[model samples]
Target: MTLYYDETGDTKLPFESLSIAETVIQGTLRYLESPYDAEVNLLLTMNNEIREINQEHRNIDKATDVLSFPAIDFEVPGDFSDVSTFDLNPETKELILGDIVISKEKVLSQGDEYGHSPLREYAFLIVHSVLHLVGYDHMEEDEKETMERIQKAIMEYLKISR
Candidate 1:
């Protein structure tokens, strides 16, 4: 698995924290039966940066905790074998999963709001974003339940609890 981090304008966040996130992400991918040759880009930035991104891409003015931009389009709870057909990076020859942009401020704030540790929230967000990268969504009730179940299971598997 290949993981990339972009912190062009962030100051308060520790870039080293992403190493744990990468582990959680890889664990999730393995749990979901994704190919070993997978790549994902993670962006950790302030709320303003994420707000601008949310506005530009999703037409929302407020900052979201995380946003996933998937490279492969598939049905929710998709098959991993189909993932082999996704776009690959020319140099690395890895399946480009997609991008996950997370707001560092929201992670801290939401962790307090949700009564979970910052580490748990961070790992949860990484797992959630990985699901999105693998064509999982929770826009509806059933989909939300399924996604939540998988997320909780992955979190449990990683021994990352709230």
Candidate 2:
């Protein structure tokens, strides 16, 4: 799997190290039980930058902790047990999973508000975003709970506590 990471937020705040972040992302993918090789981008951005992106892509006016733009439009059975059944990227020969945009400012503030370390919050968001990239949503109560359960399980797997 290829994880392309970028940052565009305040540089002063000590963000999660790239290696740790990559591990968390990879752990999330593994938690999904997917075996397909994939490529994804994780963008750590600022509030305003994310707000602009949210407006442009989702038509939402405010900045969110994370946003996912999936490359494909399909869902797999349960934690992606059948991920290999999905189509592959013709050129890359990898599953073009998608992109994840995270607001660093939100991460900082939410980490403080939620009484968790910024790194933990970052890991949580990465897992949440990956779930979305793999065709998970929270449009309903049941779906939301299911996604939350998976996210919590992944965070636990990463040993990131609240």
Clashing residue pairs in all predictions, respectively, total 0, 0
Error of 1 at 150 (Å): 0.5
What's the C-alpha lDDT at position 50 in model 2? 92
Q: Give a tens-digit lDDT track for model 2, residues 1-162.
A: 778888885543465456766788778877776677678888888989999999999899998999999876655523445445345767777777889998888888999999988888878888888888888889999889989988888888888898
Per-residue lDDT tens digits of candidate 1, residues 1-162?
Answer: 788987645445434567887799889988887665788999988889999999999999998999999988866465766554437787888888899998888888888999987778888999999899888899999989999999999999999998
- Pull out the clashing pairs in model 2: none
TM-score of structure candidate 1: 0.91
Best by lDDT: 1
TM-score between candidate 2 and the true structure: 0.89
Q: All candidates' lDDT scores?
A: 0.84, 0.80
